[model samples]
Target: MKITIWPAGILAIIFFISTSCKQNAPHEDAAEPAFVAHPVAVPKQDVMTLEIGKAAPDFRLPDVNGKFVSLSDFDEAKVLVIIFHCNHCPTAQAYEDRMIDFTNEYKEKGVDLVAIMPNSAMGLLPEECGYTDLNDSFEEMKIRYEYKKYNFPYLYDGDNQSIAIAYGPVATPHAFVFDKERKLQYSGRIDGVEKPGGANAEDLRAAVDALLAGKPVETPVNKVFGCTTKWAWKSEYGKKVEEKWNAQPSTISRLDEDGIMALVKNPTEKLRLINIWATWCAPCVMEYPELVALQRWYGHRNFEFVSLSADNPEHQDRALAFLEKTHSPVQNFIYAGTDKYKLIEAVDPKWDGALPYTLLVEPGGKVVYSSQGPVDLLELKRAIVEHPLMGRYY
Candidate 1:
């Protein structure tokens, strides 16, 4: 009779039948029932990255706990789950809770989990890190681990991604299951779903159980789908995006004290980020490139970004040239007033006239954030994305 093979039901039946036949039959070949389910095809990246049915390559990566973890160290386990995970990818973040559950479910049953960060932080840019709080860096991983209280060992391999290369993880949430001999058994996603708690960890769980029960995994090489492993060469991709936005025409306009106060008061229908910088200020020049990236990423939404030049009134041409060269995509202005103190106070009375200052102003001129120095780009985005008024737009 043809049967649909569910992991739990098929395993239970196979266990009963195999045990009964062993108890009654002689020590000769007694034909046992075999449950066959077609395995998923491997992805192109996996074919290039890892060898199937081979001994797992050994690794000694440092975990978030400050201890070194090697693959061979877990030889005591009947089956080990090696996951290529990272802190940034939303797909990886979504699977965190389920990954914890999967490990806890089988920890005492001679099964264990080791998660590897497969992307290099050097390859990561701030724009590629918009979804999560933590970057894929080891230090950020520690912060995430402590904050999340993960049950399994999270190893950092991103400095080189050598282990990631050896195992061939195509995506952040990809996994590989190995039997006691440390031979690769299954490699792919933990489940088919990409969202948090979307699918049961059936693929991974089934493979682990099968190996523990002395049965081969039914689906050995399912394809993984998530953020690609960020190789070092991909670092330039973010720069290209920045360059594209910078290539667009940059324009500047004159704003008198009344007009400048209007932008500060945010008469327009959007959240405005006002930056006070001068062409000659070193700190302002240093922060301009990142601010340009931010303008490109969020300027299309219900948000606005502009730079106000603190340059002298006669130096308006110099300020305009700087704005164009820096690729400030939004509207730009030159302070048209004589009193610098009045202008700084008009923006915010709590002001010390400082170069490279910033303010995130809500509609109707409510000042949400005011900074006297170069803004921390990552932290600034996080604050805006998490704010009650601005979160929904993102």
Candidate 2:
């Protein structure tokens, strides 16, 4: 179902519009949606290997201009090269000049070089990676192409990410080369240039060269590594980073009761995790990594998890110090001029609220699960498997 705003929020939105119109709103364009830092991890391939002889997966995607292009379109070509890339990923950007050189070199060889941006419709924020900005609409991608003078089609997979999952790409810059017979001959790193300049293992070039020689490609594949394909693998360290960040003094470490209440009121179909924790509690601190794991395991987008710090004002600094150290994902908040009971009751008077407590609130503000301790990943994963929602979060 489409999002239906509550009557009170609708009135507020109307009031906001009216207030904006009255002031002339000179800086209206300056407002931006808050950008959350995604949980980080070592990039690795989720798929370890691909068989040498199999038909390449076909895909249809839109170029920068929103024109549809398909894999089968190059049926007459002897070699079809597909590059899984994105505008914002550093690894893809690092190889920009090299990609242009490779595409140019093989075009005359009846090689169909198609570079595709396989962004998942879930989890990621495009603007965070510099792919899109506040002002970047589909039109902006086209303008960027002309401005950058790109020689290849910069395609977008807008439709529910059907092509990405089908291709099973493990990371950005994933290259696959197919012979004219449409059999998968090579798959792996662009040039074994894992970092900026390692050795020019040149895996893709070697495979292409072997195929062109009318000989079997010596190496069928290698372990591809780099910034992971955000759409391909689920993240597993949401709370670990948050705990690390929370330990830092520079970060704001309070759990704002008012802010959490607002989010509860504006809930989405995504699964919501509500954690009540404190600074002095060792169990809470110890379980911090698991919570982050739950978030990352849920892969950030699948679950909406927020943290409420129960530390007193005097301990706020220490709490923040811990947050900075661990890099927590639980949306930080604090309760002021109120006891825990009062605050919890005010948020929801239906039952008693306890420390180290977690509630899985589904959309429409329905409580799915409530417990007094840290959540178990296997149990939560089972729940997600059982219940189907439009958007899910851990």
lDDT of 2 at 342: 61
- Steric overlap count per candidate: 0, 43
lDDT (Cα, tens digit) per residue for candidate 1, span 1-394 = 9998679988999999999997987866655443222212222243255755888899997888667788788988988889999987878887888889988889989898989887765567655664665678877888878777899999887665667768878888898888888888898878887766468788998898899889988999998888888775565676786577657888877777888788899987777888899989999998987776666545655677888888888999898888777667678888887789878877778878888899988889998888898888767776665566544212
Lowest lDDT block of 10, candidate 2? 127-136
> Would you estimate the TM-scores of all the predictions?
0.69, 0.46
Tell me how many residue pairs clash in candidate 2. Answer: 43
**Which candidate gets the maximum lDDT versus the true structure?**
1
Per-residue lDDT over 133-160 for candidate 2, one digit per residue giving the tens place of the 0 to 100 score: 1112234456546655777887765334
> Each model's C-alpha lDDT?
0.78, 0.63
Q: Largest TM-score belongs to which candidate?
A: 1
Query: After TM-score superposition, what is the CA distance of residue 120 in candidate 1 from its true location, in Å?
Result: 4.0
Off by over 4 Å in 2: 1-50, 125-144, 194-201, 232-394
Local lDDT at 165 for model 1: 69
